[model samples]
Target: MAVGDPTVRTTPAVNETGEGTSTILQTRDLRKEFGGLTATDDVDLAVEESELRCLIGPNGAGKSTFLNLITGRLEPTAGSIYYDRFDITGLPSHERVDRGISMKFQVPSLYEEFTVRQNLRIPLQRAVESDVFEARTRELLDQFDLLTEIDEPATSLSHGQQQRLEIAMAMGLEPKLMLLDEPVAGLSVEETAEIADILQTIQAKEGVAFIVIEHDIDFVEMIADRVTVLDQGGIFTEGTIEEVTSNPDVKRIYLGEDD
Candidate 1:
């Protein structure tokens, strides 16, 4: 059995219909402190295979810190991280990616001067054989709806297109799990809705698990299979969207509502 607070089991690892599932990621007493300021406070999180989980919190709730720790961008002060039954606490960022963990940051990290094709080609070349590159790139472009701008410079695309392009590049790694930080930030309502649709399609078709951190409630409702709420660097509560949103305490803590 995986470690951590045994009380924090895979109850939330169920599908939308409430069928129990296995965990793909587990963190046991994961913690990080900067001097005396604790950033991640003994967080124990479990994400099931192909599940789309959302992590939400007010500013300073340590959402970014938790992600950094999981991605190996920062070392944890205490605790261990497990991915698919393997301890990955000490792996570097690149090694984590090599192990099928990919992250897309808040900002679109694209090659601004490179065409969409070129940007996608970069990672595809590294992940797949040259003989399969053309087929895989074509598939990614079609899946991301970026075929229209395949030859355009990444910077010339709209904010939403740029986001999609970046996601496509990350997908080039053929990851089993992906971490996305505020993917719809600054996008228009239509763009946001489109992004939500794209993510759902990808998750359903490819069975890739996603851990998304977003402040956009509507987008979260659209794509999340389960929701995890954080407060003061620790997991305050986790459940379905309805369960989390309807909790009086969650409203008070997450939305600053008066009791």
Candidate 2:
């Protein structure tokens, strides 16, 4: 598809502040440390509203740590995080969710014994300030193609199905920005493609921005409008997928060879 093709539904408009739109999420010299080690080092990043930005790096590059900082799972040793112009550095994870930010972790987090519908109801109930929780829960199950398995125990579902269900749970919150941490991590190629299509559809319909951290380069290229490459806890480079993929330095450092 063409870049920013409305029909393809990958690229959406820039943010609301005109040409130079304000970021939906921004970090200034964000840092995290474990004793003498700097897990995330002076990282600066911004995610525009409705944009699907991918964060990719080798293992131990602090991708998850950076995500933890933003989601308030781990406190930053230094710097700040702003969401929608509000300083949310001190907010708890649930409060951040309340403020229209939600996340799906790399691992499928579900209530193993609970039926699919019951598992989904947890987030539905939490996001129930204005919308009807039950209706939203039903809608998500349908949207994610989990309606058939709604009555099955979460553990009884396939790995791919469980992944979809976890994401559906996050979507139950109707978030403005969603952080998907390896949403397709353990799925098969076909399963990954299915989830990717669902994500694109959701992005098109809802205009929900996302920061996806994934190791699968193909998967990232498929969904990312912009790619941020991290190395040793800092941003090594960032550009459109086309730019980053062809970059010599990116290839040498991350891909370990010329393309």
Candidate 3:
């Protein structure tokens, strides 16, 4: 379906307590540190079944570190995380994936020498429990307009194409919550727009909630239903795009006065 099409139900909205009937993911006072430096500090966030939340911050603001802590790539120094109400703070990355959380990094991860179709097969193999693996893969390929490139070596695709491929692979898992870190990083304006369109389309149709970490305000504004800003490892401010953009403190600390 097209981006923002009302018919496709990707995720359910938050309930009365600002939580999903089935809270897909949650973090309570989550913190991460490296030696003397703190990367994430007391982060408390929640993602309902299919809510699209954008996390934005300046460089060194700990966006990546926070994502690592959630996905089990890095252990949190303190606090806890929950997936479907089950504690997952100590779970390994692979185990979390098996539990229904998937992440797509800013850098495209794929088998460069393998054809796009071959690259896709790896995830499909892992998704054996998914009844519609093949069909889902086909749909993802079509969604990204990469069906023709299925037979071409992944290394042969352009940077933009590679980005799309990585997203497609992540979607193949049918994740309950998708963590996308800078999915549009390094792409041209046009390329970013294309990827943005695909993301919007996926959310509308599949109800796959997303926690997108990005520096591109324009892009985040276009995709995020709500925006959260991080500064110096702490939540700086949060609100609608307009509210956050207009906040004087957010401007001074995160966006820069002139931004």
lDDT of 3: 0.84
Report the C-alpha lDDT of model 3 over 130-215, residue by residue, as the tens digit: 57666766777999999988789998999989989998888877787899999988899999999888888888888888999988
lDDT of 2 by residue, 83-167 (tens): 7757788899989998899999986679998999899988888777445766777789999989988889998999999999999
TM for every model, in the order presented, reads: 0.90, 0.90, 0.88
Of candidate 1, the 10-residue stretch with the lowest lDDT total is 12-21
Candidate 2 residue pairs in clash (backbone atoms < 3 Å): none
Rank ordering of all candidates by TM-score, starting from the highest: 1, 2, 3
What are the per-residue Cα lDDT tens digits for candidate 1 across 51-101? 999999899999989999989999999998888656788999888888889
List where candidate 3 sits over 4 angstroms from the true fold.
Answer: 1-22, 129-133
